[model samples]
Target: MTHSKRYQHRTIISFFTVLIVFILMAGGVQAGIEPSKVICRVETDRAILPAGDSQNVVLKITLDAPPSPAHIKRPLVNLALVLDQSGSMSGTKIQQAKAAAIEAAIEALTRLGLQDIFSVVVYDTNVHTIVPAQRAGNIQSIINTIQQIRAGGSTALFGGVSQGASEIRKKLESDYVHRIILLSDGLANVGPRMPEDLGRLGAALIKENISVTTVGVGTDYNEDLMTRLAQKSDGNTYFVESGFDLPRIFAAELGDVLNVVAKKVKVTITLSDNVEAINIIGREGRIRENQIEFYMNQLYGDQEKYALVEVNIPKSTSGSRIKIAQVDVTYENPFSRKPEKSTGISYASFSSDSGKVARSTNIEVIREYQLNLNALAQEKAIELSDQGKKKE
Candidate 1:
C-alpha cells in the first residue's frame, strides 16, 4: 500500500475512536442523571350533592411512580408497636401477628439500613412492655420477644396506646419519625378511662408531634376507636381481615412509614362561598394554631404525593359561577428546592344554586365508619355495665 494511503487510514481510525469515546461519555452522563422526581396529585372533577342533604364522595388518586431506588437514605424511624394480646387474639391471630411484626422489623433493618428505635407493647387486661423503647440493633432478640407474646384477659386498648405514646415521646429529640403502631381486635373493656376519653389523650399526643397508626384485625373489632386514634394523631388506619394477611401489610406499611422523606406536611384550603363544604379525605388535615397541617403518614420517594379534597358546590344556573379552593402543601425537604421540580396541586369548583351543598371522600367514609364504631363500643360498654349491676 502507498504511504499516503496508510497515513489516511490511520487518521480515519483515530477519528472513529474519538467519536466512539464521545458517544460513550454522553451515554454515561445520561445514565448518571437521577430518575425524574415523583409527584402524586389527587382531585375530583365533579362532586354533586343535594341541597340540604349529605352524601359521601370518594376521590381515588392513583400513585404512578416507580419503586424507590435502592440506595436512597431511608428516614429514621422511632416506632412503637402496640399489639393487642386480648383473649380474642389467640391461636392464629397472635401467631400471625408476631410473625408479621418480625418480618417487618427485619425488612426495615435490612432494606433501609436505618437506625431504628422500636418498642413492643402487648396488652390484654393490662399493658406489658415486652421490649421497652430501645434502639433496634439486635434483630433476633426483638423477633424472639415478639413471638413470646401470648393472648390473655380483657382489652385495655387505651392503656396500650398511652404507654406506647409515652415510649415514643422519649425519642422526640432524635428528629426521627415517631409513631405508634396499634393493633387491636376488640374494644377497650379494662382501662380505667372510657374509650372516648382516649381521643383526648390522642389529641394531646398529636400536639406533642407523635403520630399513631392503628390496625384493626378481624371483623368484630372496634375499628371506630382505632380510626379515631389515628386521625387525631395525623397517622393512618388499616383493616386486616385475617392473620395470614398481616405480614405483608405490616412489612409494606411499616417500611413506608419509616421511609417518610418529609414531616409536618401542611395543606391549607381557601374556599369560595360557591362551595358550601369541603372534605379532605384519606388523611386528616388539621387546623393548627394559625396554619393547617396534614400529618403526612406515608413515605414518598423522589416525587410529591397529594391528598384528595372533595368540595360540594351549589347547582349551576343558566350562567357559570366560578369558585377557587386554593390548596397549599408545605413540607420539610432535606434537599434544596429545585424550581424546575416544585410539586403542588390546584383544585376549584363552581355552582349557582342558593341551596346547601355537601361533599365527601374516601377519608370521609372511613371517618364516618369510625364514628359508627365508636357509638357501638359506647353502647356495648353501657350494656356491660348494666349487666354487672344486675348481677350484683
Candidate 2:
C-alpha cells in the first residue's frame, strides 16, 4: 500500500481555491489598528479530497504578531500570584518561588508603564492573603509580604486558586489583562482535591476574563492537574526541574502578560455544508454539530498562537466548489479598549487531477501535520514503555 493509502485509508486528489477575508471590524476604529498587531491565516493540508469518500483535512489557523511598542504601553494588568506553601515546598523551592514572585513577576509588570494590579495568596492547608489586589506601585510592600510566606502543613491547592480568583474578581476590568500565576510542588490534600475540580475552577475563572498559569517546581507535583488548570483557563504551563528555574519561567510568563495586545480572544469556526467539524488538536475547545468555539485568555506581543481542526470532507465530484471553513475572531483590543472582530473565509475547489492536488499541497500545513503525527507516536511509545514496566 502507498503512504497515502496507509495513512489516509485512500488517496485524495483535490485543489484549493481558498479565499480568506480577514476583516477587522471595531466600529470604524479598524482603520487606526495596525495590520501587524494580530493576523489570522488559514491553510489546509490538501486542496482536493477523494470524491465520494470522506477524507480528513487539517485546518491550520494561526494568530500571529505581538503588540507594537506604542500599543504595549498602558495595557493595564490584574494579576494574582498564587503560591503553594505545602510542606513539600519547604526549603529552597518555596524560597525561589517567592523570589520569582517578587523579582520577576512583580518587576515585569512595573516595567510595562502601566499601574498594574497585583495580589498574592499562599496556601498550606489554609489560604492566606499575602497581599490583596492593589496597585503594583508599592514594590517594597509586595516584597515584604512575599518574604513572610513560609511553607508548612498539607497542600490546599484549590483553596489558594479560589482565593486568588476572588481577589482578581474584585478588581476585574475589561481593559485589564487578568491572570493568576500558580506555583505548586505537591498534590492537593485539602478542599476539592481532584483535577476535575481544579479544571472547573479554571474554566469558571476564564468566563470572568481571568486566566491561570501554572508553574510546577520540582518533580513531586501532579503535571496532569496543573496542566489541566492552565488548559481550561487558556493559560501557560511550565515544568521546572529545579527551583532555580522558577524565576526564569515566571519572568517569561510575566513578559508575555506585559506584552499582551488583546484579551478574551475567541475564535469561532463554522464549517460549510458536507464538512464535519472534529476536535481541535492540542487546545481546549468545543465542537458542536458543525461549529467550533474556543478561546485564548489573551494574545501577547510577538507571539504566535494557532488552532488545528481535524475536519472531515465529504465526497464530492470534480469541478465542484466547496466552502470549507469560516473563521471569526472577537477580541478586546487593549489599545482601543474596545472589542474588535476579524473574519476570514476559506473555500476549496474539487479536482480529480492528481497532479493538481499534489502540486497544490501547502508545505506548511503538511509540516504541521507531520509534527503532530510524530508527537502522537512518541506519546504512544511512552505509554507502551510504561505498560511494559508494569508487567515486569
TM-scores of all predicted structures: 0.61, 0.81
Residue-by-residue lDDT tens digits, candidate 1, 1-392: 34433332232222222211221121001112233333545444333233333323333232333344444444466778787777666433333344444444444334443256777777889889887877645555555555555556898888888899878877877666777878777768886445467667778887776888877877878765777677678777789776556666565555456445555554555554555444544445654323333545344564445454455554544233343344454554422222212233434333334342233233543454455457658868977866747431
- Write down the TM-score for model 2: 0.81
Could you give candidate 2's per-residue lDDT for residues 12-127 as a string of tens digits? 00000000000000011122544344677777887665455667889988887555455224466677878776666653333333333344433433344425677778888899
lDDT of each: 0.55, 0.70
Inter-residue clash pairs, candidate 1: 38-302, 38-303, 38-304, 39-304, 40-304, 282-363
Output the worst ten-in-a-row residue range by lDDT, candidate 1. 22-31
Error of 1 at 251 (Å): 1.5
Clashing residue pair totals per candidate (backbone < 3 A): 6, 4
